[model samples]
Target: MSTITLNDGSPVPWLAFGTGTALYGKDASDFVKVAIENGITHLDGAQMYNNEETLAAGIKASGKPRSELYITTKLKILEPGQTATEALRVSLRKLDVDYVDLFLIHSPSPANKEGKLKALWEEMEEIHSQGLAKSIGVSNFRVEDLNVILEGAKVIPAVNQLHPYVWKAAQPIYELCKERGIVIASYGGQTPIVRAVGGPLDAVLPAIRERLEKTRGEPVTSGQVLGKWILQKGAILVTTTSKASRIKEFLDTKNVPDLTEEEVHVIEEAGEKLHKRIYMRHVFE
Candidate 1:
């Protein structure tokens, strides 16, 4: 698998098997093990997901060496008198690892609402310096929220994980992150297919898929077309599924022909026809 290099030079897998959404609040050991066994090396988890221990169990069951995997978890909630470092240490314990590849502020709401985003980010940087988290970033952060920390951030966020899709491309944040060297890690890349079934992309995806099938000389699905769209847009895709076939299909997206610039434009235009958000509605609102 190819990797996306961060500003700090840490290589992250382009496609990650995420333990969110469908796996949230659930024991994800089996799914994690299956993802690892099927060639996915990056595993995305979060303190908010409340399944890190079971996720660790699945990593153990996969029999893949810890060195062979890239693991990420987020800081969800900081308790009273609790520091970000302290919270991450607890997460490290649950993940059964000394350090994670990426650690993020789960959302800007907590610290931003409290007017402490800078302080929280300093703590995140401190943990990074202590070798607790390889890279630090934020999730569900908007331009205003990012500006809060970026104003005085010693370490600019390496990533901003968001629910970016055809319907909601998050172009403003995306452009800003790109300018600042922060990569966008996208969850819900397939939202249009699953959640907004009757949208404009319904008519658009099949024609694009047909063209891709001709180029790749194999069958293509609407999901792969969207996956290609996400990749071409230069964002990391974080996705999950319960089916083995689905996992393979997603993994195979890396092998498909890249989407044409026109195809990408068509999809984007179709997406603009209807706006929908499957998760983290607060981020958009």
Candidate 2:
């Protein structure tokens, strides 16, 4: 799998198998095992998903060495009197690992609303200092939230994961992260194909796929087209599905032909015709 280098110098897999959404609050053992067996080396998990133990189970079932897998989990709001270190230790126990490749604040809502985003980030820095997580970051963080943390932050965030469709492209956030060397990790990349199927992309994706098929001499789906678009834009993709074939399809996206500049423009223009935000709307609002 291709990798992206974080600002902190950690190598992150460009495509990660996310253990959320469909696997949320459920036993992810079977699905996670299947994903690993099919060449997915990066696994994205979280405390909020309520399935870290099951994710561990799947990891064990896959029989891949811990050193070979790049594991990541997110931190939820700290409990009463609970330190970030304490919270990460809990996640580490659940995941049965000494340290995670990456750790993130699940959302900025709690800390931002409580007026403790800076303090929360201080604690995250503390977690990194203690060697509990190789890298630390924030998810669903806006430019405002990032500013709050960056103002007092000693360690620049390694990444900021969010949904980045063309409609809500998050250009401001993208620009800030780019200036600061923070990589953008994208989820919900297929919102146009899955959630809002008949948007402007419908008219454009087919032709792009046909062109890519001729270049690569293979079939390409709209989903792969979107995934390739994300990859081409230099963002890590966190994607998941219950089906093995779908997992293979997503993995195969690495070989899909890149989108031309006009094709990318067509996608961006189509996305602008309508607005859609499938997950974490409050973060953008």
TM-score (all chains, Cα) for each model: 0.97, 0.97
Give one digit per residue, the lDDT tens place, for model 1 in 201-277: 89999899999999889999989998988888788989999988898999899899998889989998888777677
Residue ranges of candidate 1 with Cα displaced over 4 Å: 166-169
Error of 2 at 206 (Å): 0.7
Clashing pairs in 2: none
RMSD of 2: 1.2
lDDT of predicted model 2: 0.90
lDDT of 2 by residue, 1-285 (tens): 489999999999888999998888999999999999999999999999999999999999999999999999999878899988998999899999999999999899978988999998999899999889999999999899999999958999999998876445587888899999999999999888888888778899899999999999888988999999888878999999999999999989999978989999898888778778877777666
**Cα lDDT listed for each candidate:** 0.90, 0.90
